[model samples]
Target chain A: MSRRSFLRGCAAFGGVTALAASLAPLRELGDYTNTEQFLQKYYKELTPSDMTKVITRIEGEVERQYGIRPHVRDLKPMDGVEFVYALNLTRCIGCRKCVHACVKENNQSRSPEIQYIRVLKMPHGSMDVEKGNHNYDSKQVPEKGFFYMPIQCQQCKNPPCVKVCPVNATWQEKDGITVIDYDWCIGCRYCEAACPYWARRFNFTKPQIPKDKINPDMSYLGNRPRKQGVMEKCHFCIQRTRVGKYPACLEACPVGARKFGNILDPNSEVSYILREKRVFIQLKEEMGTSPRFFYYFDK
Target chain B: MAKLDPSAQKKSDHTANYWLGGLTAVFFSLTIFFAFNSKPHVAAQPEIPLVDKKFLDTSPWRQTYADLVKAKEDLSDYDCYACHDKAKPPRIRYDTNQKIIIPKEHANIEMSHGTHERNNICYNCHNEQNLNTLQVRDGNVVKFDNIPQLCGSCHGPTLRDWEAGAHGRTSGYWDRQLGDINRLSCANCHNPHAPDIPTREAAPGPHYLHEASSHEPSKSHR
Candidate 1:
């Protein structure tokens, strides 16, 4: 071909390629086919139309991935079923049943480092909090003056994790439960580090769950398989508890050490427990976490 | 300048043109190489085949999630570490990694279980499933794996504390609402080797050396 004609042909080819490249973002925005690659923004940034589209996409993705359709709640919290939990330190057997339940129930990655609960084992007769060790070892109960205190997300009424999230990735609902928008979280780890109880865990990698083993019973907000590099914490099993029933840890504790009920109802079991027990929360003074989880030693 | 023969003039012109073309070509080639190398390439890798033979032959396993049915069986067996090659099996990490040493004759039965035997393993209470999932019974889907039901599966009274939010850590951002959200396995906390808490060397002890007061009004000093 002549040199001038060849140059023109080359220009045409380059132009077409550039057009395709430029249109890529628009194509994704119109229809989020590549949900995995298309990272979502915080709830505050989403418009009503954007939210509708995003929610539709999320529901579709959940069905595609898990084979089960979850009822994603768009409505606000109900008034009466205010979820709550309590722990009896005296009755605790130091068995880590609760921690394991959390891993499986929350669809957590199978890593020891990501455990939600850290049972601080302190020597008997010692009031020093600094000396307590979370790394306890025992085959049976009572490692010679050591008692178990399982620590997890306190579901604080005034949650610090919600306050520190830069993107507002996490917040408390009307019922005093802290919730996280996993897609919006930037994996900053600020919330993780800020939690005095070390309750919040970050998905350092795409959570590893055996496909066949994937828990079909997952809520959009809780226990769904999470993507890599986002912060997550206990949601008090909103999918389950909001409907009624009990928590996994409460069911698993061999020593009758856990309790749960509605705090809103003065006649509920939790209200009674709080009224009768001399209870205390973890790190109450420094942070004012105002946690709903309370602990009392019966002895 | 003297008039030259046609053949000689033609040969001189060809040599000059050849040199110019060669220089231009060299410059363009270098420019193209650098420009192409600077841009990033975003491409997806091929997926792993489902068959076992293919998996075994593959040099590096691609990111394929495990089969769900097989995974349920694996969960029952507690063999999570087998496929995840990165996992180091839970070992006793302190004091030569042997059986934990608790000082004998210490008061507190909860701490002194050297003789009293405990029956439950990791799964008895933590179980094959976690509490957050939906349970369908008799054609009805029941949400919330009540702590009482699971704890009552093993320990009856513990369910009471879980509901009251008084048995576990009360400070983190996890539990307290619904009680069903708490992690279940006993291994999540209370490491099986060292039961005693770690002590800080930097901080002073709670008690300190005291000196007698000389200015006491009607006491021993007076």
Candidate 2:
């Protein structure tokens, strides 16, 4: 054979080999081998009856897997309400109570370490996020001159993550929380890359949640068990918050540093923070994400 | 159509049959190989223990007014009239350092509120005439449930922030129309005597998958 023909043959062989190798991981997906899930309709397309069936299927699957019958439902956003968060930098002591509280409440994989909130231990003067350390070892909190800044999904008005999704799996809800449909997500990781705050967590392997530790209260778009290929971020505890309850993080905070409420309500705590307090930080405001989460100082 | 070439035709047909038979044998063998040999992969669950319950608890340890009201039995500790006289006013005592010595009977009360030692007096908050009632700086008597009014007289900014839901913890519904709201009073979280918050044990840091499995045991959170 001529040189050009030999090269073409090699290229074809290499392409076939690469394609075969890419599909090898699919063999390990035994638990998700159900044909029923593959045939299920999209989130919005599912009618009320369809939703009930889907919820039942989910409940059955979770009960079979974890031996706990979880209460799963799709919580729709309430009308005339826009959620916003105000974190007091002055009062925060870097206790990390919110982090673990979120984990317990959200049913995040405990072993593979999926956490929604990350409190940055920053030195007194610096405002740059890069300077903050996440792995600070200390006996107690509010140590000396150091201040804490807890970061989570900002639930931005204009989210870059949503813009980059190849599949329309993740979107901002009416109540200003961005949610992900685990069933529909194709796991491109484009949203993970697009997030400025490093909020999105991709499951590199199958998530390993302990049976007893799993929060049985789960919502379709919130703390529901995400598969290996999907992405998950903070949904402001949709399971609790949608039913007119405070997020676990807010309830857990010992210092009362974290504040959350409807921005539409003029009397809300978050509104009061924005109006009266010197609420200055939006965290990457220059990125134009228009995050609903705000940080403020006492002085 | 060519009947004279039957023997040649038969030989060619036999060769084609052999080829077809070999292909069919190979296909069946491959199917058997896959069906018998390829066990469906199941991911092994990692054996990572949950963190201690000390870290998982998120609720505030302090008692709210509603909680106090609900537990009527726990209210005996706050009953001042049970021990003190109701008719006579408690006499105010000041030492040379302008600090009132905490009486032996009130050993649980730690009266170090301000740097100036001026707010340590019992009458600063407590009603002198009626020990059951608490008084503000304005000499107005306030109930135990309305302790925020008395705290507001001294901590004006903090009280304002608390009223606006900016400074303290508020549980229950953010939407007032839907559910019951629980706004914690001043005494719920802070001790009126020593207003400064103590540094307690913090929760454990994140345990990454690849990192060392066990975390150093931290102190229990109160």
Candidate 3:
């Protein structure tokens, strides 16, 4: 063969090998399609029979992977119930008990350390979150002129995260909780960028929860074992809250700084806080996304 | 183009069209009926009880105070009757000769409620007649659980806030339908002798990316 033809042949072989190597990852995509997950419909679009089949398939998959039977359900929001949260700034003693409680209850990824609640220690008189410090390691809290403010997914009524989702994966529920369908999320992280509170977290790796520490009480739209490359945030503890129980963070708070309840109920604690105390939402002037979470000080 | 009966041909065509139309109508009606009649696909919410009643019962303050009071009120070791009978006890009098003198038996007790000079005596809070119980402004004897009423005699506003679920820790349930709501008594959080909540090491804060680098003391202090 001529030298030019021989070089062309060599180049052709190299191109073919590189192409084959890159396409090898497509086999994993093929595996997803082969399973029942590819046939899964959008959460809102699922028919009764489709839901049953999808849930059963997920149960089987979880059992195969985790070696533990998880009871995963798609809990519906109750009618006339708008959940609201209020934190007493004066009462919060800069204790990070709520942060760890959220991690355990929500089945957050343990390896890279994802916590829903971020307690920011702000200077005593300032409300500016920009000046707020999240990594304050003071020896004793309420450090003279500083107060702790814990921030979580505000569960906004008009969430920017939901708006920016390329796939209709994340959306606000009727009860005002913004939930992500782990199966449906494309892991684009657009929602993460859109969120103002830094509430959304992207799972970089498949969550490595200890088999013993795994929260078996899982919900489909809430704290079920999330796969890698999906965005997850606080769903107001849908597994517990939908069943008429308080969120884990509220139970874990040592100083009773957190308060949560259905705002529609006239007698609910949240309603009383809104009506009585000097209550305000974070970024209230932002105007578009009306967050259900409120911060208040005692009168 | 064979010679045929026109009426018969027409009749056959009419019958076929009628049957076709009738079938389409039936199919559409069935679809509509099924669409409307099918029940909503509400995912079966398993009745999983979320709250652990046992965990709720274990209040941080309740157990501590209960244990503390139980240890002090161990009647087997120290009896209140040994010092005073059922009749009203005498008012504590300070001897002019001595600059400061608490009873030798009660010397170990610390009276740090307000100040050393103001209302430092035991009779101020404790019912002299019954050393074991507390006393309210109305002279009504209050139980340990009802210490708030005694504290309310002076700190009325705080008592009101506590009742309104503002001043203290409330756990268990916000909606009373699921479980009993628990409110911590004043003694649960505050020591009766030392009213101020003591300082303690705060829990570790969030360690976000570059958070350590961003902690500038000069900027934060400003």
Winning candidate number (TM-score): 2
Per-residue lDDT over B1-222 for candidate 2, one digit per residue giving the tens place of the 0 to 100 score: 856688898899678666655555555555555555456555554455667788766556667554677777477767787887888776767688877766778778778788865577788888887787888877799887888888899889998998888888778888788887777777777877887777777676765545343452323211
What's the candidate order when arranged by decreasing DockQ?
A: 2, 3, 1
In order of appearance, the predictions have TM-scores of: 0.53, 0.83, 0.76
The DockQ-based CAPRI class assigned to model 1 is: incorrect
Candidate that beats the other on TM-score, 1 or 2, i.e. the better one = 2
* Candidate numbers sorted by TM-score from highest down: 2, 3, 1
What's the DockQ for every one of the candidates? Answer: 0.03, 0.28, 0.13
User: Which candidate number has the best lDDT?
Assistant: 2
Give the per-residue lDDT of model 2 (tens digit) for A1-299: 96445545555555555455555556767576467778888888989999998899888888888999999989999988899999999989898889988988898887677888988988989899878877776787778989999999999999999999987899999999999999888889999999999899988777878798778999999887877878999999999888888899998888889999999989989999999999978999999999999999877
Give DockQ: model 3: 0.13
lDDT of each: 0.55, 0.82, 0.74
Task: Write one digit per residue (lDDT tens) for candidate 3, span B52-150.
Answer: 233223255434335566567554333566766667675565668422356776776555577554656666788877777778758889865577888
Stretches of model 2 off by over 4 angstroms after superposition: A1-28, B1-47, B64-66, B74-76, B79-99, B116-118, B212-222
Which has the greatest DockQ? 2
